[model samples]
Target: MSTQVPPIHSTAAAPMLELRGVHTHIGAYHILHGVDLTVPRGQLTMLLGRNGAGKTTTLRTIMGLWQASQGRVLLGGEDITRLPTPAIARQSVAYVPENMGIFADLSVKENLLLAARQARHAGQMDEERLQWIFGLFPAVQKFWNHPAGKLSGGQKQMVAVARAIVEPRDLLIIDEPSKGLAPAIIHKMIAAFEQLKAAGVTILLVEQNLAFAKRLGDSVAVMDNGRVVHAGRMADLAADTDLQQSLLGLAL
Candidate 1:
């Protein structure tokens, strides 16, 4: 059985996700300053920035982990700015945090099981989707019964991502999927993401890996001082070295 996701044309549809003039305050600190971003339907949007530039904060605000002090978050044109985290998640959005949130003590299968809300047990889980995920990350299957804590960093990261896709998701927001990964593992990660893109998942990624970003990103947004300073096609950004230097202080 084919598990291919139906493609949504990137140019013709409204954005899968949008943030307008978003502001977030983490305790006494104001982290985000009116971030405006658009994740086009069925395309991967890379969020690039220097450290502490509020990339992660913007993602968190969209996921409702951090409430926006101002502005709005919209998913499929529905206002979700003030929705609780669970409510937002129920709207078919999946978030993989920078920390790669997973239960260390739980088996890899158990970790994935928790993400399949409609499935109360492994038998009830979607076999086709599980097989599809295994094709993307074999480590998840190889370590199915092993404690997630026992897996290496790359494997754990794989499990984190695999968990997010256990069920079909309309939008996937991942923070640094390539961070702290070995080159070989990063290559596999890139391939998996490419397949995800081909399958028409609308993804927003906060990535410091410019090479990885260039390969998988369809659209690019560069953040600095808590605001997006540049937004355009990934190819345009990749082809312009001076623009890369100005926005990111480095070439792709």
Candidate 2:
């Protein structure tokens, strides 16, 4: 049998985000067990794992939503594990949770405006960036004054991502942007993500969709039992059906 070690990429490049020996606990039950992963600068890294594998827990820990009982979370070589959520956000990290996190009562414009921390009002927002976001997700522009709850599922997903990138961010972390979307919408999302990557936005995504992961991921990490069981280039994993089946429990 051939030995398989977690593959590392772009060693010359410093990681925009790193987790070292991270552990998380919720009440008496332990969730994460010493997870170590790295997300390279200007690259899209995908986090994959089956249900109950602590994928979401890892992201929550990074966001400071759930305090890590142990370990270090680093961004640009700075330790941010202990920082508060607002402090983490101030560092230019945008997290879009699986639930989409949109205010049902707010207008689409209001949602994007709220995400621009420096802008107190719609007019104060950076017009160029807003235009770019509109170009990326046109639903946001088409439904500017419409209540968010009135939009369709795919439109709401677009709005959620639009809100995240309403301003320049050092890192964009999203959980399952393709979840519950039609094939056409997922294709559009893949294109949007490609554009974001081309523009040099670092992305960390937790996705159950293998096609989505294979399409946008520059680097990939697969978690199992609350630990990273495999890490490598997305292309490497995509080309190896056997490895995919072993790590993800099914071939892509």
Candidate 3:
């Protein structure tokens, strides 16, 4: 019932993360079917798919939240398929789920403080880095003392990303950062991600917004029926309207 995806060539000399023939099962339902993906180092890779297409499942599997039933997940040339979630995170990888994952009961500052392993208190967190993050997402500074739950959706999203980057990370994986956000907030998010990429962070994003993907992604992989149906440069996919509609069921 599924159409086949032609092989996608590697655009980067070396990939920062790769999923090779991965399979994931949820209860009796098989989610990912031999998914192959590559995220190049220091680049923004977009994972796009229709609903029920297993984009989030793929991200979760990479994060070790859901164990892969088969295959390998490589990070920086190391096999991390079986590592625990914390261990994976400690490997300089950060994952932000769709829920924004901030502690609603904690203040924005507290939430960020908790994310930094070296910092016990706000004073202990890297001052220069914190300032840089604040500059990228000013909402974080504006709502510093407010409970994360009290902030608006967009501000909370900022806190979530700020927490992920509270410390330097090699890879950052986020799920649908633009979901339910206003156009203006989404634009700001786009800018923040651009800055993060500039700071040498390799990012893997599971997004449904075509405009967001086109704006920020250097590489793209499209999933359907749990397999990557397309992989190539973002510009290649963006420029081909017919191919976009075929893979994603919509024009770019």
Candidate 4:
């Protein structure tokens, strides 16, 4: 039987975020099954899989949304497996979930302020950081005074992503970025992520859009049945039609 040995960077620089055989349960039912994944320093790694493959759950596990039932979650090589959600947020990790989680009544500035307040440890995020965020997604600047509730779907999505890393994070976990958006809007969002990556943000992206994933991913992990089934360089997978068809059930 041929098995793909997922290439894990065994270096000492320390991964920005990592999950070692993580297991999680929601309510009375267990979900994640021994998931192992890692995000190297300054790398844009993608967790790609179809629905129900535990992609979002994996992101939740890292963000301390669900405390791992087993295994370890490390932020900069320190064990954070038992940390609370708020505590995890303070660990230089930012999470933008599938739902976006925007405060409908809050204005764009208010949303950014909330994230800044929560992340403003040791004067971590200053005016400069906030400006940087606004610059990355200029649309946010235009809607600064506008209430998020009145924003369109694409605008809200931009705000959700902006709020998550407004304070600057060592690691960013983004879930299903391209879901339910016009192709044009998705293109704009893609550029925003590219800017983040170019600025050296280590990202763990959980996305279903294969074409989008190929654009930003330095490496890819295709998950299924709650475990990673295939992992390789994005370029390698992009060229292998058979691998793409067999694992992701996608053409090209």
Q: Highest lDDT: which candidate?
A: 3
Q: Model 1 segments beyond 4 Å from truth?
A: 1-12
Report every candidate's CA lDDT. 0.92, 0.92, 0.93, 0.83
Q: What is the TM-score of each predicted model, taking all chains together?
A: 0.94, 0.94, 0.94, 0.89
Model 3 error, position 243 (Å) = 0.2
RMSD of candidate 1 to the true fold? 7.4
Q: How does candidate 3 score on lDDT?
A: 0.93
Can you write out model 1's per-residue Cα lDDT over 1-252, one digit (the tens) per residue?
A: 966634333334568898889999999999999999988899999999999999999999999999999888888877888999999999989999999998999999999999999999999999999998998899999999999999999999999999999999988999999999999999999998888888888999999989999999999999999999999999999999999999888898
| Model 4 C-alpha lDDT per residue in residues 1-252, reported as the tens digit of each score | 976634444346888877888888898878888988878888889898878998988888887877789888878878888899999888778888898999999888888778886554424557687777677677788988899999888888889998887777878888888888889889988888888888898988988888888888898888998888887787789889999898888855
- Please give the TM-score that candidate 3 achieves against the real structure: 0.94
Per-prediction count of colliding residue pairs? 0, 0, 0, 0
Write model 2 residue lDDT over 1-252, tens digit each, in one string.
966634334233558999999999999989899999999999999999898899999999999999999888888777888999999999989999999999989999999889988999999999999898888888889999999999999999999999999889889999999999999999989999999999899999999999999889999999999999999899999999999999988987
Model 2, residue 208: what's the lDDT? 96
Candidate 2: residue pairs that collide = none
